[model samples]
Target: MTEHATRHTPPEGPPGDGDVLLVTDLSRRFGDLIAVDGVSFRVGRGETYGLLGPNGAGKTTTISMVAGLIEADAGTVTVKGHRMGPARVEPKRHIGLVPQELAIYPELTARENLTFFGRLQGMSGTTLASRVEDVLDVIGLSDRAKDPTKEFSGGMKRRLNIGIGLLHEPELLILDEPTVGVDPQSRNSILESVESLSTAGMAVLYTTHYMEEAERLCDRIGIIDSGLLQAEGTRDELIRLTGDVDHIRLDGSGDTVAAEAALLALPAVEQVDRERHTLHLAVHDAPTAIAEIVTEATSAGMRLNDVQITRPNLESVFLRLTGKALRD
Candidate 1:
């Protein structure tokens, strides 16, 4: 939401100074089909970089390579200046990955789950104890830490899954759809926790199907389709590429032909369509031009009944680029 980056892959050199994650010309294959084709992006310190795509879009595959959970058939993944791979242990310490599926035990309490994962990452004694409590607070689950995960709400358990990933406080955190099936209130809490993490200076690589989440949480976003990184930039920057214009519609009575003639002469109006008593207009800067458009139509002898405007957002851009809705 604050900082931004468009460096999909930096120039060949030591991984772009402060870049926490650098993926360049990354590719992968599953038998004959290409699952990931030349995808690249970077996540800088304190930056929340969102990767958005529908199912079977190579999002999860890319995350797996970045986390070194799997090997890349081609290209490279560097984390905190070290090369990353499944066999590479050192660089793995700087990365924390929270998968889409719930990675917790229903029999264990929140605190127990944190302590267990913390110990797996080599923490013990007071350090693990302190971190478990801290994470419980960060996830807004402090009061419910002792309840079995099965007793927790869907959102609560999801938060605990995120807390497990946060236990080590790695420099780069990769979250894959952390709010998939949770209730709205719980989803908001998870979002708030992520915001706080970004503010505290942790780099995050996020992937989601929600446009609002990307617009709200990410400093920059990368849209992937058919195993390719289609575009990357800040929300406003990407929207500008859509070349999408706002619309103004007018429903009225009286001289429709005269109003159509007058509306065409307006500088802001791009095109107009008329069907019976209503005129549908394609216009730029609708907010600033609506008043002028309404006056012109009324002056042309059309008595106005109602007016409406539709503006473009991230979803519009997504639809334009991918030829499908984000959820589709």
Candidate 2:
């Protein structure tokens, strides 16, 4: 079981400024193996909360339970004060889920797909038509509204997937790795769409293995590993939990093995790794240690090609706590 610092009781009414999604002691099991073990966190109104972990870290299982697609073995999921279970229609109404897969129909036009989902959500007539138009504008596909989705680009299809989620304008939006296989241009478009959605006051629960996305889009993040929530907080708070360390990378030719050993012997250096021509070092005080590192490289007969000092961020924090890369 995972331990939480504090526990919150389910509120009586709509989650007043406190939280939109409150998950407490959530755990799930598959026969003999526990998938999600005691995860807990809260996402406030209009806030973006990121759930980050490596593959098989239980992120998908946890999200499946939250979406009411699977029943939890133990614990509670409260969405805007309503408890979520197999037959909870009200809570489900408040959530719009955009899964990792393409949920839009390839044969239908963008507008048609929106209308189809909008009507399924109980929309109709003028309201449904207006919503479809509005969603097309929001997704930047108004020009392509009448074009068949099969003709759309990968990014456009992804945007349409998100449009399906917004057809009902649910109070909370859950996006699961929406940018997986798209090109850089398409990825940026999808990210911009997410930012706009949050600005429109929709609480978002996002799951991604990409550290940059989590850092850019999340107001707070929960890091889960091995079925446990290792830490949960804002980026700064999570980084602080990993202690103050700066990551430095040096790319050079010649004697990388000797350079790696010399850097590791430094008093400020915590770890050293060498990959062919590149050397990665984690140090206590980077600003003061840069000169020492260069000196050590010179003394070790390394022909330096490039040097970079990167400040610690979510990736570093994740590496510190999980002891594995996020992509792993």
TM-score of each: 0.85, 0.77
- lDDT per residue for candidate 2 within 97-206, as digits (tens), equals 89989988999999989998887788899999998888899888999998999999888999899989988998889998888898999899888888888888889999
Candidate 1 Cα RMSD after full superposition onto the native fold (Å): 4.5
Residue-level lDDT tens digits of model 1 in 1-328: 0012222343356666679999988899999988898888888999999998888889999999999989999999999989999999888889888999999999999888899889988889998899889989888899998899989878888988999999999899999999999899989988988898999999999999899999999999998777888788898778766678888889989998899999999999999999999999999889999999999999999999999999887898878887789888
Off by over 4 Å in 1: 1-14, 253-268, 287-304
lDDT of each: 0.88, 0.86
Model 2: pairs clashing at backbone N, Cα or C within 3 Å: none
* Candidate topping TM-score: 1
Q: How large an RMSD does model 2 have?
A: 6.1
